[model samples]
Target: MKPRVSILAALLLVSVCAKAQDVNVEVLQRDLDHPWSLAFLPDNKSILITLRDGELKRWTPGEGLSAPIIGVPKVWAKGQGGLLDVVLAPDFAQSRRVWLSFSEAGKDGKAGTAVGYGRLSEDTKRLENFTVVFRQSPKLSTGNHFGGRMVFDGKGYLYIALGENNQRPTAQDLDKHQGKLIRLTDQGAVPGDNPFVNQPGAKPEIWAYGIRNPQGMAMNPWSGALWLNEHGPRGGDEINIPERGKNYGWPIATWGVNYSGLAIPEAKGGKVAGTEQPIFYWQHSPAISGMAFYNADTFPQWKNKLFIGALKDKNVIAMTVNGDRVNEDGRLMTSHKQRIRDVRVGPDGYLYVLTDESDGQLLKVSPKR
Candidate 1:
C-alpha cells in the first residue's frame, strides 16, 4: 500500500518563514515506523531500509515498498536498541554481500552493538547464510547509546562505531571495546596492521578510543580519512577525524556538562594528556545523527559541503568545510520539523534523508529546477 504525505499547516507556515530555496523536499515514502537507516542499491533506483522494530524492507521507484525481507537476526528493541545502520560492501557489485549493525541481545537482558553481513537472496526475499561477525565486549544493561553506524573506506577495511553504553568512564578503558571505533576485514577478521594488535590487553580490533555515543560515520572523499560525529551530555557535540591509536577524551575531558546540570568531574581542566581535540564542536548540541558529503553535479552550489542531520532542531545542518575547520552555512527542511535520523547522497546525485518518528518518512532532496 502506498502512503500519502500529510503536510501539517504549521509546516506550511514554517516554509514561508524560513525561505529554504536551494533544494526542495519531496516526500517519497511515508508512514514508516521509526525508520533508522537507508542504503542505496547498486542499481541507483532501489534502496534497502531498516526499521527499529527489526524489519528489513526494500524499496524501488516503480514497485513502491516490498514486503519485509526474511532472515533478520534477533535484535534487542529496548530504549535505544534495535535494527540500525545498513551499508553495502565496497565491492557489493560482485560480492552481493551487505553489512548491518544492530544491538545484539545477550543472556540476562544485556545487550551490545554487533556487526553482521550476509548475501541477499536472488529474489530479494531473504538473507542467506547470515552471520554475526563482531560483538562489543562487556555487554551492559543500559539500553541507550548504541553507536551502530558503519562505513567502508574503499580500501579493504570496514569501520564500525560503538558507544560507551552510558557508562562514561568506560570510554577510556582499552581493555574493553566500549566507546571505540573498530576496523575489520571484509570477512570480519582483524587486520594485522591495526594499531593495538600487538598490545597484550587491548582489543586488536580497536582503531581509536574515548568516544561517547557516535551515530555518524563517513569517509572523506578528498582526504581518504574516517570522520565521526558523537553526542555529548548537555552540550559539546563533536566532529573528529579518528586517528589510529588516538584517544578522543570522552568522559575524561569534554566541553559538555553532566545531564544533572553539574560539571563532569573528569572534564574540569578541559584538556587531557595524549588526547586529540575535535576538528569542530557544537556549543549548543544539535543531537547530530547521520552525515554525508555533497559532491553531486545535480546541485553545483552545494558541492564540497558536509551535510549533517540535526535531531534537536529537526533540520539538516549544512556546513562549509575549509580544510578541517567547518563553519555553519545554514539549515534545511526545518519546515518539516522532523527528527532527521540518516542522510545520504544517493547514486543519482541527490540527497536522501530518513525521519526518526513513529510516522516517519523517506524524503528526497533535489535542486529546484
Candidate 2:
C-alpha cells in the first residue's frame, strides 16, 4: 500500500534568489560557530538551530537572524559533546513545548547524552523551564560519541539514540547506558508499552541496543519506520532499522576496524543470529552527520529520496528509498571544502543545509538550470 503524502506546494520565502536559471546559491548569512542541527518551527517561517559551541540561534528569511537565544543548559562542549538536535512537540503551536538532546558532564566529568524538554517563549525562539527528561544512568566519561538524535513515533512516544562513547564493550553490556536507542514518553518518561518494560535487569527505556556513533537518523517516508546511521572507524558505515529488544551487532561485529591501523578482531567477526543487520552499509565511510526524507514537490525529481550530509566526503548525498531499503543515487555539493554538517527538508519543497566550518553557512537548494 502506498503511503498518502501531502502535495508540497508551499514556497517558504521569496527573495531575489541568486539566479533561478543557473541556480546559484548565495550566502544569505555566514560566520556561524559550528552549527550542528536545525529544525523548522510549525510556522515554517522561522527556525531553531543549535551550535556545537553551545549556542542556539533563531533564523528567519526577511528579518535575517536573531541574537543567540539564551536558556540552553550547560553542555560539556568537548570533542563531540555539545548542543545537538532540536525538535518541537507534536502539539507545538498550542503546547509551546520542544525537546533537545545534548551532552553534559557528570560528577566524574565524563560527558554523556542528555535529553530535555522545555516550553518555547511565545516567539518560539528561546527555551524556558528546561528540565532533563532523560540522562544516561551510571554516567561514565566516554567523550567520543553520544548519539543525541530524537524522533517521535506515531504513538507520540519519543525515541532517542545514544552512542557507544568509544567504549565498544559497552555496546553489548546490558547494564550500561552506552550504545542504546531509548523509548520514552513525550515528557521523557518510560512508556509502559516498551518491549521490555517488565523484564528484570533490563532498562525499560531501551528500545534497541548496540550503536557506535549514530549521527544520521530519519523516519522512513513509506514505512514510517525509524532509520539510523552510525560511524565506522576506517570504513563500514551502517544503516539499520532498529527492532524492539534487538541488538545491532557493534564492536563485537562490524565491517570496519579501528583507525590506528590495528584491526580489532571483533570488528571483523562475531556476526551471528539474534543480531540485527544494516539495510545499507558504506565502505570508505563518509562520516555522516544528519539525514532526511525528501518528499518535496519542488524537486519532483528527488521525491521519495533520502538526503544525507557528510563531513569527510564534504558533499550532500541523495538516495533512493524503496520501502525500508535504499540505494545511493547522487552526490551534490557546492564544490567547496566546508564539511556538510546537516540536511533537512523544508516545509516548502526545498533542502536547507548547514556546513561545518569555523565560519559556516546555511544554504537552501532549489532547481538547477
Candidate 3:
C-alpha cells in the first residue's frame, strides 16, 4: 500500500528584501515512533531512520518503510536513553558499513552513551558483525542527558557528543567522559594528536569538555568546521564551534537558571575566564536538535545558510553564517505545529526534516511554484 501524501501549501512565508518567499512542505512518511535522527543513503532516495524506542528502519519512495533492520544493540530505552543517531561510513558505497550511537546499560541501573558499527546485509534486513567501538566511562544512574549525536569530520574522524547525565559538576571534570566531545578513529581508537592525549588526568579521546546535552552536530561544508547545539536548563541554549582543547562552561557559567526558577549556584555569570563563548545563544531556548548546512542549488536563496531543528519552538531556524559569527535569518514551518527533530540537506538539494512524535513524520521542504 502507498503511504498517504499530504501537501501543506505555503506553510512558510518569510519576507526577503521586500519579496515574499513561499515554502511547500510535503509529508513523506508518517507514524514513526519518536524518530530521533535520519541519514540519507548513497542512492539519495533511500533513508535510514532511528526511533527513540530502539528500532531502525529504512524508507524508500513507493516502497514506503521497510521492516525494522535486525541486530540493533539493546538500548536502555528509558527517558532519553535509546537508539539515537545513524550515519553511513565515508566509504559506504563500497563498505556497506553503518555506525550507530545509543545509550547502553551498566550494573546497578546506570547507563551511558556508546558507539558501534556494523555492515548492512545485502538483503537489507539485518546487521552483520556489529562491533561496539566506544563506551562512556563511569556510567551514571540517571537516564536523561545521554548526548548521542555523532558526526564525521573532514578527515574521517568520528566525533561523539556526550551529556552530563544530569550530574552537573561532572561537566568540568577532565577525568570523566560525561559532558565532553570525543574524537576517535573510525574503529574507535584515540587519535594521537588529540589535545588531551598527552594530558595526565584527561581521557585521551576527549576533544573538548564542559558541554551540556548536545543533540545537534554538523560539519560546515564551506569551512570544514564542526558545529553543535545543546540544550540548557530553562533557557540559554547555545550554538558553539568547538575547537581543540577548548572548554565550554556548562554548570560553571551559563545564561540559564535552574528549572526551579532559581539561579544556578555554581555559575558565576554568562562568561567565565577560561571558557569559550557561544557564537550564538538563545535566551529562551528552543530545545534545538539536529542541524545541517544548505549548500545546494535547489534553493538559491538559502545557499550557505545553516538550518537547525527546534523542539520547543516547533520550527526550523535559518541562520546566515559569516566566518565564525551567525545571524538569525528567519524561521520556517512555524505553522506546522510539530517538534522538529532533525534537519538535513538532501543529495538532490532539497531540505529534509524529521518531526519528533509518536506519530512523527518525515517532511521534504522545497520552493513553492
Clashes (backbone N, CA, C under 3 Å), per candidate, total 0, 2, 0
Candidates' TM-scores? 0.93, 0.90, 0.93
Return the candidate ranking by lDDT, descending: 3, 1, 2
Error of 2 at 231 (Å): 0.7
Q: Write the per-residue lDDT of candidate 1 for residues 223-338, one digit (tens) a residue.
A: 88888999988877888999999999998877778888799877744467778777777656789999998877877888888999988889988877776666666778878899
- CA lDDT of each candidate? 0.85, 0.78, 0.87
Candidate 3 scores a C-alpha RMSD against the true structure in Å of 7.3
Flag regions of model 2 displaced more than 4 Å.
Answer: 1-24, 268-270
lDDT of 3 by residue, 243-341 (tens): 999999998978788999999878988888898888777766779999999888877888879999999988888888887777666778888999999
Better of 1 and 3 by lDDT: 3
Q: Between prediction 1 and prediction 2, which has the larger lDDT?
A: 1
Error of 3 at 59 (Å): 0.1
Cα lDDT of model 2 overall? 0.78
| Residue-level lDDT tens digits of model 2 in 1-369 | 111111111011111111113234556568888888898987878878888878888888887778877688888888878898888888887888778899988888788889898888986566899999889775765568888988887677888999988888888777777898998988778988787789887778988997888888878867888988888777767778888888888887676677876776566453556677677666567788899998767778778888888899887777678887666656677375679888888898888888988898988876575
Query: What is the Å distance of residue 308 in model 1 from its true position?
Result: 0.2
